[model samples]
Target: MISATELPSTRPYLIRALYDWCSENGFTPYVAVKVDASVQVPREYVQGGEIVLNVSMDATSSLKLGNDFIEFKARFGGKPRDIMVPIQRVMAIYARENGQGMAFPVNDDEVSSTPLTAVQPEPVQSLPEDDPTPTSPSPSRPALKRIK
Candidate 1:
């Protein structure tokens, strides 16, 4: 089992890679479970929604998680459960011969190519063309008072 701390400081890219693979290969594998349940998310991510996975390779029927632990089950060939795997324990993903599997390897030097940025975009300003003309505010007239 590889703790997140044991992995490189970079976010484990396995999740993103799996998402892309499923999309391209017509597999409906989804994150199914988020690492941070406390993180605020749009209603769509939780309401009537099961992460909308790309389930082409194997059909995941259920997911479970515990303290520092995560697990899931997948179905195949019309069977209720064809595979049982853990999230953190998964290293390499393999879907072959109508089945899905995971590998656990201990390597911490793999570089995640995603870039982190600290600079934010500046607000845009609309400037008037240099016509060198000044505009004045409109003036109102005073009401006439009756002299007694």
Candidate 2:
């Protein structure tokens, strides 16, 4: 018999499912990623040590949402750049329009967020105007908040 620890994590699967949901519902899919050395993205666009990516079909090309990594080519500031993010590094996946999504546990040395049942709303800074990768509009983005 296999131990529970040996079981595969549902993170990647959930990520793919949410992506599909957003795509089918005409919602723009965005992923909040915790940046570190392992994450490959434009450093200039990162804010508060995190970056939100627009993974919608219209935003990315050659996008591959894999079990271990999400690979894609996107344009930032009119320059094409290759973006890669580890599955575990994704802190949250939510729709840019409705602000509904899931938050995942991030095991980071500098910062950490506990797993939650659903996303909570909070004010977050907007992304740079010139940067192609952007967070949700209206200064509002899904946030991970502890509910007691």
Residue range 27-85, candidate 2, lDDT tens digits: 99899998988899999998888899999999999999987789999999999999999
Task: Report the lDDT tens digits of candidate 1 across residue range 1-148.
Answer: 9854454422235544654565477554433322123222233434332122223434444443332233445433344432322243223333332334333331223222222212223444544788555544223211211111
Which ranges in model 1 have alpha carbons more than 4 Å from their true place? 1-12, 27-58, 63-70, 76-84, 95-104, 107-148
Span of ten consecutive residues with least summed lDDT in model 1: 139-148
User: Which pairs clash in the backbone of model 2?
Assistant: none
Per-residue lDDT of 33 in model 1 = 25
* Local error of candidate 1 at residue 103 (angstroms): 6.7
Cα lDDT, model 1, residue 57: 36
Backbone atom clashes (below 3 Å) for every candidate: 8, 0
Pairs with steric clashes in candidate 1: 27-54, 27-55, 27-56, 28-54, 28-55, 28-56, 29-54, 29-55
lDDT of 2 at 113: 31
lDDT of 1: 0.35
The lDDT for every candidate, in the order shown, is 0.35, 0.82
